[model samples]
Target: MSYIQQSFSVQFEYKVFFTEKIFDTANTDFANFLESRAEKGIRKKLLFIVDDGVTKHHDYLQDQITAYFENIDGFELIQDIIVVPGGEASKNDLQLFYWLVNTLDQHAIDRHSYVVGIGGGSVLDLVGYVAAVSHRGVKHIRIPTTVLSQNDSGVGVKNGINYHGKKNFLGTFAPPAAVFNDATFLATLDERDWRSGMVEAVKVALIKDAGFFDWMESHAGLLTQADPASLQYLIRRCAELHMAHIGGAGDPFESGSSRPLDFGHWSAHKLEQLTDFELRHGEAVSIGIALDSVYSWLTGMLDADSLDRIIKLLKELRLPLYHPLLEIEDDQSAIVAGLEEFREHLGGQLTISLLRAIGKGQEVHSIDLAILRKAVNMLRDKW
Candidate 1:
């Protein structure tokens, strides 16, 4: 056993900035960030990849971005801002992934140059993966435009695309250079988009902050109506909780099987695929939370009053509590098969996060199928 040992550690730090109209000429936040990263003699390039859905709503976005960067020194912005389709379908297209990679190559986007992804979670995921694999890793920035992306996925280090109809089947743990969360984009989101996006907040509050959960419960009406103040607070709180878990939990890359942040995500992932992605990620997670909450009560892990409060809050927010596909038909049912897949994704035991109280979450290595079935039926029949 005569060999040199390998030992090294890399520190990753990035800021998630909250702003309105990030591309506005008067907004110096984006410009200031670029200025700070500029090298003395190097004129780094920036390639902007946008979501087509965003362009449709904000038609002046391209011109706005170009003009904003015009006066910024030490950086050259690529004029041809590429726009691609958004939503989960974007992650399912391998050709789209390669196309973007080829675009990066043609434009000579090197490691020093930055790839800025501006869109929802799915588009950001694709762009991040592309940047991560390109030149072994390129500097990438995120301008998340939706509630889901801004509060959860946009602030995290995971970047991935769906492979063979599986959610995030292929991906990497590449942190971005920085993330700019622009709240203006939330204004154009459809009711479903904004409504389903809040599930992440509910999830994080359930697992970590009972006080936050109580706040949400009190503001359920205002949140359901998408009141600006309530919505902003929800997004900020959720992002903070998510960031704290990622940085302070000692497992930013998820080297272990315990994923408390993924309390309701196991079935949520499968439900998204099972419904052909008709259900929004948040919507599916809403149902997953409901089912798991009921299951927790059935298993005696959570009190009945806590379960009632959870169910009531979800209902008041208008998030779904059940989907037909979630019904356990048999041992080989599609939803049931998801357990094994989820276990494989974790690379160890079948760990699932269940609530012990409003703000307390505990991880279990195994689940009782019979009780799980009962939980599903209870949700379907009662709620």
Candidate 2:
């Protein structure tokens, strides 16, 4: 028998626009976004899904969205905007996934229709999955509300929800039709969300741009204090770096094992699950970054000064550098199990990113278990 091989490539492009007060009719960003794709005499249906936390804070949000689309020649806003549980809770339950699909079906949303996910990263992940899977992919737009989403997750192409108690166990490699990062939604975030979101920026800076890391060091005070200009610049710069990596890495879908951007994510993911997601993503990342940095130091790969700077920056930014769960030892090396899980997740050899310097990273296939234990103990002592 003979075999036949076929190969083809598809082009992917989407705009990531930064705007404030997107739903205000006076602010034409949202309208412009929809109208850009409009055909003469054709009205596109829109299903707006809001996060419960966001609705609680902005009670007028649904009304505002309806008013914004009223009589808009290009789009029709569904009268009922569905609000779902926010945070990791939205991702942990698989029921919400089907519920969203059923709701879209009930509203007669088709491929041409738009599903706008408006909330933090979790809501975006869940809603984006719904849009990607239902009816073989509808046009989905992301309106990321939290600082974390605005800077990192919202800008990326990956969409995922937790499965079987694993972080991002079920997900897709689908990109949104567009990503609208509305800075206005950031103002209402509680202090925890406000501060935790910047952790991704620090992670990116430490690995790819030392100068950016320097900038973060200088403005750590402002970031922690919620300075608007500083935060805006941070988010934009972080998003730009992430987008650059995705465009240049030759692995946007992460088909390969080298995940440079996930420098601190292995432990972070495990920490999230171990804590039952009580630790916010960014907070868990902060600890992961610290754990990895200390491990790098232990292995003599990173200088003490660089490790000090990294830790100081995180602490100054009010990010948690140590979590007690990291020290927990049970029937197995609980936290160390993250290494195997991470490898399993990658579906190949273990590939981890460790610091070579403040602005650079190196990938390794395996980690020294003895050194890893030492790093955990070091963090415990500091705590």
Candidate 3:
């Protein structure tokens, strides 16, 4: 069977666009797309908004992207625009969406023009947000560089950046024209970043792919170490897990994570806010997952083995199960205060995904200031 079967998925009437073998196939897909556009008399220049890291080798991959399609529409149009360094750090309102939006406006890019994001989740998020708001939305294509983007952020079509210390505080629900996921980019990543991506893979499995999580438990070390086989399995499974549920949920653009099937996210987002984005999102989520699962156990929603198993998997992956920053906090009161921001930011009641049992998850109102305090205290003592 083609890797396409392993690489992409579409569901529930929501259009999902993807280039499974990005590097090998991107140019051909673009050529075919441009040909159709030309036949239809569509006039549009492509903006190549790329990440700095992708260009680090400037000698090869980066320049190759621009050179591959230096001109299209038979060279009649200017056909060029490159944006800034891409990342979650770059996702700040100042450098990413704002810069790209202004750049497009200054260049007089119209609805006919399109933006192509070339980087990991951050670039995809920020650029997609810019494209959505530019002239009331324009065409945007996502070339997700990292695993986090490919399996989770990239395919989801939610866009925006962190603001005022909140992650994804400002953004929109705009799907892209397409997405490209090249396993080759995995080669460019170091160990730390590769593990960051695995956190998302774990989250996907925790949500619905019980079997995937089972595989993850057995291969956590290998996955952390960047074993290609382990990495490939995690990527494809994570992508499939999310696509299954995202296709059925309410619009992902409305904020508050819009879907708290993201159980560990409440505390996770708070931890990130406190860390000034230094803590990788996946790291925060791993900690959050642990805390949340412990809460589930405490309340009789889960038993000891399930909680231990979850934390064990994370530890095996080398992801932290506790927030080191929480150590400085005076008491549970400080921790409770941190979680409140997550509830307030979403502009809705606190919606948390909780576990009734392993293989079963449910949402509930407020994690309770008191219960959260207890959980924090217990985590501190245990860690």
lDDT for predicted candidate 2 compared with the true structure: 0.91
In model 1, the clashing pairs are: none
> Which 10-residue window in model 3 sums to the lowest lDDT?
12-21
Tens digits of per-residue lDDT, candidate 3, 106-201, equal 777777776878788887888888889989988787777787787788877688888776778888877777666767777887667778778877
Candidate 3's C-alpha runs over 4 A off are: 1-27, 33-39, 57-59, 70-83, 93-96, 250-258, 327-334
- Name the best candidate (by TM-score): 1
Model 1 spans > 4 angstroms off:
none
Superposed Cα deviation of residue 60, candidate 3 (Å): 2.1
In candidate 1, how many Å is residue 6 off? 1.3
lDDT of 1 by residue, 319-368 (tens): 99999999997778888888888999878889999999999999999988
Which candidate has the top score in lDDT? 1
**Model 2 error, position 58 (Å):** 0.9
- The residue-by-residue lDDT of candidate 2 on 160-195, one tens digit each, is 899888878888889888999888889999999989
Q: Quote the positional error of residue 263 for candidate 2 in Å.
A: 0.7
Comparing 2 and 3 by TM-score, which wins? 2
In candidate 3, the residue pairs with backbone N, CA or C atoms under 3 Å apart (3 or more residues apart, or in different chains) clash, namely: none
Please give the lDDT score at residue 322 for candidate 3: 79
